[model samples]
Target: MLIPITREKFEQLIPLIATGPQYAYFWGKLPMVLKRLLISVVALVVIFLLGLAFGEGFYFFRLLFSIIAGLYWFWGPIYWASRRNLEIRRYKYSGFWRGRVLDVFVTDEIVGTEETVSNRGELVIVENRERRLNVEVGDETGFTTIMQGPLRRTHKGIAEGQVVEMLILSNQPDLGRIAKTSDIYIPRLNIWVSDYPYLQRVIFAQVSSQLSEAEERDYPDNRAVINRRRRR
Candidate 1:
């Protein structure tokens, strides 16, 4: 059923608390993240020591190392924590309640999309259109809430009033209501697809039986695959 975003309705929706590896909060990095950070430090140190031999000619290298080190020490862990939070939220969303699409609208922000050509190097283009959606989800008591989520480029053809499933954080201590991710049900494809995380897309693709009878299809074309580790 179509639902509108309302304060009263929002209170009715349930939030899923994600259960997974809990690191040492902000200061702690997952084992893999720590490994990467260590590797980066070693590489940077090697580069810096090598720069000394070049004297003034490699001042740029020393400056670059300083900036990189500063960013790594100050910004790297925060970035890792943010991404880990997304994954934890996704884990929670995996067990969220069902919902339906109520509305869809494109946003003004333009994100760059990239592709790999068969015989060519990587091709990149800016996707001027980004979309968002409002979804209506209900609990067994039939109470419903309309929550909003971002639409990836892959979800372009999704229409309003389509059946959608939602994953919302159940243990929100700050905000009363929050929608983590939304998946559109494609009957023909018989699977749920979302653009939150590529790994998540892959997991959903493999677990089609948990969803519907749609055939397995590739992830959205020309969408950016966020490699959080690689980005660092």
Candidate 2:
């Protein structure tokens, strides 16, 4: 089952900041109004200086200033604006969608795994090595699969099934069809986690939890045997 998402819920679930480190720094620290004001002020100053140079008949100086100002005003904002606009548009499309998980399937492909090893002078202690699961989630409309590790990187041995709610974008819902998993984004993590919300939530929550278990089921005593021999 898939349901529609509301603006309020989507705002609460998405991350506070959704961008690269440089932009994230601004997003995390400053409000949107302040960001806009700062950029506007800088742009005006650049324009003012360029105007002054041109008025003074300093063609060489005006040209140099114009080039620098043009790059900053044109390219910088365009880059940031494009990224922000795309994210906003994506959320708008997905915000109205909600659905339930009907089935879960494990894919044969293994994305990656996480392991921890502790070593002593003579004995090498291997602790946990968690395998990543690739999963496919089926809904009332269609199936959406995740290409990355199904479980959170932090949760190693927990083989939990997908049984949660999610949001989906309907490309042609009038015809009773749904979009692909790749076209969906999990607002909770502010990233694409397939079109399945339940699976995304499980993996994301696992990453935040303190559950640690060995990836391998059995650990033989011989595996930890120390290499101790007297010099002969």
| CA shift of 69, model 1, Å | 5.6
What's the lDDT for residue 198 in model 1?
Answer: 20
lDDT of 2 by residue, 34-98 (tens): 55556656865776776776686766665675566545533454455345434543534332232
What lDDT would each prediction earn against the true structure? 0.44, 0.39
Query: TM-score of each candidate?
Result: 0.35, 0.34
The alpha-carbon RMSD values of the candidates against the true structure, listed in the order shown, are 16.0, 18.6
Give the candidate number with the greatest TM-score: 1
lDDT of 1 by residue, 1-232 (tens): 1223233223222112211211223344355467557767886787788788888888987888767764574456456555654554443223334444445555444534444454456555535454555445454445466544455555566565454444444344432455444444443334444433222333333333333322112333322331221121
The worst-scoring run of ten residues by lDDT in candidate 2 lies at: 223-232
lDDT of 2 at 32: 49
Most lDDT-accurate candidate: 1
